[model samples]
Target: MGSSPSTLERHGYTVVRELGQAVLVNSKDGDQCVIKKINLREETGKGSGNTDVCDAVETLLGLSHPHIVKHKTAFADDEYMYIVSEYCSGGDLYQKIKEQSEKREAFSEEQILDWILKICMALKYLHDLNVQHGDLQPKNIFFTEYGMIRLGEFGEFNERARQAGSTKDGALSYISPEILDGKTHDEKSDIWALGCVLYELCMLKSAFSAESTVKLIPKILNGSYPPLPHNISHNLQQLIEETLQTDPGKRPLAGEIIWKPFVLSFLTARSEKSIDELNDNLVKLRALADGLEKVHYGATVGSLTGGVIGAAGGITSIVGLILAPFTLGASLIVTGVGVGVAVAGGATAGISNITNMVNQSTDRKNIRSIILEFQEKMNSVVICLQHITEGMEELKHQISLKNEQQSPSGGTIVKVGTRVSRGLGAVPELVRLLQVANMGKVAAQAARAVRVAEVATGVFSAFFVALDVFFIAMDAKEIHNIRTTKASEADDMKSKLVLQSPEATDSDSGADQEPKSETMKFVKKIRETADELQMSLDELKEIISFIPKLPDIDA
Candidate 1:
C-alpha cells in the first residue's frame, strides 16, 4: 500500500494513474514520471536485505545512461520510500509481446535481432561497471515514444523483492537456473535471463511456461526448453543455446554477444546501404574477424609458453636454481610476460602466413578462399584465448593473495623484475609488427586488425609498467625492513657504547645519534617509495581492466 494521489500532491506532483504500487505523476511544469513506493519494512530472508536495497537505489539514482531509464529524484515518508523515474509512454516490451501473442504472431528474425542488439548494448554498459541488472526480462524493458528500449525497474527494490521461489507468481521462466539453485550470480545471470526473453520473442511463447513454479524450476535447471522452430536462423539458435548454458561462466559476456555474426549481419542489413558501401564495410568486418583470430592464436601460444615454464619437469637445472628462491612471484610475472611476447610474436607470424598464402594466388577467388580458411580457425583460437586469460588472471589473484599474507624477499623481487624485463623487451618487436600491419595492404582488408594490434601493444606496455611497479613496491618494502633492522642494530651499539664508557662526552653521544637520524631519513624515503608503488599499482589495475573490452572479433 502507498500514499493516495491527494497525499502525493503535497510533494509537488499530481498522480495521473496508479500502476500497481507505483503512480504515474505529472509535475507542475507538465513533465511526467513514475514514482514507485518501496516499503523498507518488508523483510526478506535472503540477500543483504533492506539496507542493501537503500544503497542500491542511491547508486542507481546517480547513474544516467541513455539506454537506462533515468531516476530523477527520490523522497521518503514514515511508511515508504518513493523513487521517481522518467515516464516511457510506449509502455514495456512485455506488453508489446503479449499483444503479438494475442494475435498469434511471433517477432520476425530481423525484429528480434534489433531488439536483442539494443538490450545487449545496455547490458554491456552495465556489466562493464560491475553492476548486475539482477532481474532481466521483457517486463523490465520499457520503450520510449520513439521506440527505443530503456532498461528499468532495477536498483535495490528488485534485488530484495524478487526471488526465484515466490508467492507472487513472478516471471520464474526468465530466472537463471543458477539463481533458482540458490547460488549467487553476476553478469552472466543477466545473459541467461536475456536468452529466455529472446526465446519467448522468437517463438511467441515462454521458454519454460508452466502453471506453477514447481514445474518451471526443473525445466530451467535441466535446460529443457522447447526446440526452436525450424525456420529460425542457425546463428540465432546457437546464440540462444550458448546463453542458456547451465554454467554461468560458460555464458558469453554481453560485449561478446553484441559482436556475434548474426547481430553484425543484422546491423549491416539494417543500414540499407548500396552494394559498394556494403562491400567496403564487409572488408572492415573481415579484418576485425581476422584480428580476433590472431589474438586468439597468440593467447594460445602464450598459454603453452606459461605451462612449459611453470612445469617442474620443463625447467632447466640452471634456470631452476636461479628461480628457486622466487618461484611463485617469478613464475606469475614471467608467465604474463611470455603471454605478451607470444601474443606480439603470433601477430607477426600470422601476418607472414597470410602474406605467403595470399601471394600464391593473385586471383580474388584464391584470396577469398585463404580468408575463409583463416576464419575457420577462429573458433579454436577464441577458446584458447579464453583459457589463457582466465589462467593468467587466476595466477595474478593467487600472487596478490600471497603478497598480502607475507612480504616477498629482495632476491625474489630482483629475479621477478629481471624476468619481466626480458619479457617486456619484446615490446619493440610488437611495435615494429604493428607498424608493418598499419602500413601494409593487409590494413585495407582488416582495418580493425590494426586497432587490435594497437590494443595488444598497449596491453603489453601496461603489463610491463605494472611489473615494474610491483618490483619497486617489493624493493621498497624490503628496504623499509632493512632500515628498521639496521636502526635496531644501531640502538644496540649505542647502548653498548654508553654502558662501556659512562664518561663519554656530549659530542660523542651526538656522533652516535647521527646514524639514528640517517636511519630515520631512510625510513621516510621508504614510506614515500611505498606510496609511489601504490599509485602505480592502481594505474596498473586500471590498465588491466581494459583487457575485457578489447575488440573481440569472435564476439
Candidate 2:
C-alpha cells in the first residue's frame, strides 16, 4: 500500500500494504505512486541529520537522473515525514532477479542492453554532477508493467551517505577499491559501480554476495565483480574490466568511454580498424598547428616597421627646426630652439627606451608582448618627433608669410650641434648623420629590454630634479674656475717682476719673491684646464636641462 487512510481520502491514492516504516500506494491519477515515511532525526557523524537531508532535498529536486528516482514532492506531519515518488509495478529488480535465478529462469541478452546502457548513462550523469549513489543494488531499479526500467530510492545516495557514514557510502557488493581503501571518492568510483551493475545485469547474480555487510566488503576488494555468465560478448567483458581498474586517474572519461569504436564494432564485427591510421591523423594536426606559428612570425615584423617609421620621422623634424633660422630669422631662434630642445630630449630618452626593449628581450614567449610595447612607444616618439619637425616647418611658414621661402643649408643626414642658454636650460641641437646604434646581446632579450626601459624612465622622471640641480652647481664651479685661474696668474706675474728689481732686498721679500718655476707652469696649466672644463660642463648642462623642456610643444 502506497497511501494511508486520511492521505488516500484527500489525494485518491489506494493503500495496498505497509513495508516496515513506509506504505505502498497506487495513484488514482493513472500513475505509479510510492510514499515512504521520512526519518529526519537519524544522525550520522558528518553534520546535523536534518541539515544533510535539507541539502539532499535541494540537490534531488533539481536533477532528472534516469537511474535515480525523481522527487515528486515531500510533506511531513507531527509524527513522521512523507516522501512521494514513482513506483515500479514490476517489483524491485533485486527481488525479481532472486526469484528468477532461484527458480532457474532464463534472462534475455536484449534486456541486458536496455538495463546496462541506461544504468551506465545515469551513473555517468550523476558523476558529472559530483553526485555518487552510495547504494546501487538492483532493488533500487525496477521494471514497469510493460518492462520499462525505472530506478528509485535516493535516500541512501552516496554523496550524502558518505557525509553521514564515516567510512563507506555504498553497498558492500559494488563499492570501488579506492573507496574501500579509504581514498577520496571521485567520478571513477562511479564507473566501478557501473561495472558491478553491468555484471549483475548480465549474470542475474550479485558480484560478491555475503550474508553480512562486513564479509561482502572483503569480497568486493578482491574483485568478484558480478559473474559473467557464458555467451556474453568479449567487447562488453573488456569494457567492464577497464572500468574496474584500480587507479581512478587511469579511467576514461564518460564521453570518451561511451563512444569507443568497440561499441560500434560490436554491431558490425567485420569493420576495418587500424591503430596506425589514428597516429597519422594526430601527426597531420600537429603540422597544421605549425602553419599557425608561421603566421605569427609575420605579425611580429610589424614592430620592426614601427622602429623604422620612428627613425625617419625623427630626422625630418630636427632638420625642419634647424632651417627655421634662415627661413624665420629671430623668430626661428625662439621657435627653432624649442624644436631643437624637443628633438634632443626625445632621441635621448625615446630611443633609449626602444633600445632597452630590443636589448633586454630574452624569453621568446613574452617577446610578442614586448614587441607590442615597443611599437606603441615607437609610434609616440615618432609622432612627437613629427610634431617637432612640423613646428620647425610652421616657423618656416610664418617666416614665409613675412618674406619668401628659404631652404636649409643641409639635409637630415648632416651633423648639427649648437649651444644656447635659456631658463629652460641649455638647448643643444643634436642631429645624427647616421644612427648611434647599440646592438644588444640576445641571450636574455626581454629582461634586458625591460630593465633598460625601466632604468631610462626612472632616471629621467624620478631623478631629473636632482640631476638638474647638480648640473647648475657644476656650471657655477666652472665659471669660478675661469675667474680663479685669471686672478692667480695676475698675482704671479707681479711677484716675478718684483724679484728681479730693487724690492728683492726688503724684509717682506716673501711677498715680492718670484714663484718657483713649477708654480708658474702649474698656473699656466690651470688656465688651460679651466677653458676645457668650461666647454664640457656647458655641453652637459644643455643636455640635462633640454630633456624636460622638449615636451612643451604639442607632442
Candidate 3:
C-alpha cells in the first residue's frame, strides 16, 4: 500500500536505508528517525472491524519516558500509514540474545537484572496510567549508542499484531498458558513474557519449545519447563518460577517483582542515588516531624505566655497612668503597646489551632492545597515575628524614655524593668524555633511527594521486606526444590481424586480447583506478615499526623 520512496522524500525526509518494514530517515534539519509503513486494510483484513490503531498511535505520541522510545509523529497517505519515532542505534535485544546464543554464553546476572529492572520500570509507568505494552518481546526492545535500553514497538503495533494473527515462528514460546486457554492478555501476561525473557537470558534458549505449535501447546499448558542452571541464584530462580505460573492468579505483579529483594539489593549496591534519596527523605521526614511537634508545642506555649504577660502589663500600666502623676505619659504609651502585643499573640495562637485542625482533616487527594497551606503557615510565622519585634521595640523605647525623664526609681519599677528585659531577650530564641518549624513543614511536604511516588508504583516498603523474608525462607534445604515439592503435592492430590466415583467427581464444581500449592500457602503467610508490618507503620505515622501550623498575627 506504500507509495514510491520519492513520495516520502518529498515530505522533507531522505531515506538513508531500509531495516525490515521501517526505513531509517533523516529530516532536512538533521533529525534521525525511523518510519514504519503499515497497510491499514491489509493488517485488519475484512470483517475484523478493528480500526483503533490510529487512536493507539496517537496515544504513543503523547507518551514520553526515558525507558520508552519516543514516538515523534504519525501520518497516513491513502492506504498506507507511517509512524515516525526516535531511532535506536544499538539494535534490538533479540539480536544481542541470538549473538550470545551463538557463542554459547549467558548474560551476566548484573546485566540481566539491569535490563529486567529497566523493562519493569517502563511497564510500571504504563500500567500506572492503565496502558499496556501488549507485545513486549525482546525484538521490540531497543538500545541506544550509549548502551541504554528502551522499550519500543509498543501501542499500535500490538493492536496490529492481534488483527494480523500472532503466528511468527518461536512467538508462541512466550505466550502465557492462560492465553493458550482462550483468555485475553493483561498486565500479568506481560509478567509471563518477562519470565520467558529472563529464562532466555539465563539458559540462552527459549523456556518452552517443541517441533510445532501442536506440541508446544501441551508443554505450556502443563507448565513443565527445564530447570534453571545450578549456577543461577535461588532468588532469581524463584522469581522466574513465580512469574511463569500457569495460573495468572498466582503470578506476582510487575510492581511487586520490581521491588523484590533481589532487585532492590542490586539497585542499592549500585547506589542509585535517586532511589536512595527517596528512602532517606522518608527517614528524615519521620525524625523532622517528631522535632516539629515539640517545637510547635513550645511555640504555642510561648505565644500564650507572651499574651498573658502583655495583657497583665497593659492592665497594670492603665491603672498606673490613672494613679501616678509623674509617670502619666510613659504609662499611657505602655498601655497601648502592651494591649497591641497581647492581642496579636493571643489571636495568632488561636488562629493557628484552628488551621491545624482544618489541615489534619484535609484529604490527601488535594495535595496542592496541603502544600499551599504549609507555605501559608510559614509566611504567617514570618509576619508574626515582625509584629512581635515591632511591639517589643515600642515597649523598650517607652521604658527608656520614662527612665530618661525620671531621676530615681523604687524596687517596683526595677522589677518591671527586669520583666521587660527578659521578654525582649526571648524574642530571638523564639524566632529561631519558629524558623526550624518551617523547615519541618518543608520536609513533611517532600515526604508526601515520596509517598505519592510509592503509591503510583503500587509498592510498599513493608512488602519488599516481606519479599526478603520469603526469599530467605526459600534458601532452606526443604524449600530449595520448590518444583519437586509442587509435583509431589500434585501427584498426591491426583491419587486422592482418582479414588472418588467418576460421576461424582465430574459433577462436583470444586473438582476443577487445584489443591493450594505449598508455594502459594507460604506466599499467603508472607503477605499476612506484610500486612502486619504495614499496620504497625500506619500506627507510627499517626504519631506525627499533625503538621505544626505557625501562628499568624495578620489572621
**TM-scores for all predictions:** 0.48, 0.41, 0.48
Q: What lDDT tens digits, residue by residue, belong to model 1 across residues 1-555?
A: 247565578778987877764678888645678887765566434445567667777877976454678788877676556788888877898898999999998788778976786677678778877888877888889976545568887634664434334332356777888888898868889999999988988887788887777787899999899999778877678788888998887677775665442343344334222223323323443333333233222322222222222222122221233333322222211232222233321222222232232222122222232222222222112222232233233323333443444565512333222221222223444223323332223213233333333343443344334333433343344334434544565555444433442112112454335322222333233333334333333332332333332111222
- In candidate 1, stretches whose alpha carbon ends up further than 4 angstroms from where it belongs are 4-7, 42-51, 159-168, 268-555
- lDDT, model 1: 0.52
10 residues in a row with least lDDT, candidate 3:
361-370
The numbered model that scores best in lDDT is 3
- Global lDDT of each candidate: 0.52, 0.43, 0.53
Pairs in steric clash, model 1: 259-555, 260-555, 287-446
Model 3 segments more than 4 A misplaced: 42-51, 155-167, 271-555
> Which TM-score value belongs to model 3?
0.48
lDDT of 1 at 316: 28
Q: Is candidate 1 or candidate 3 better by lDDT?
A: 3
Clashes of each: 3, 21, 0
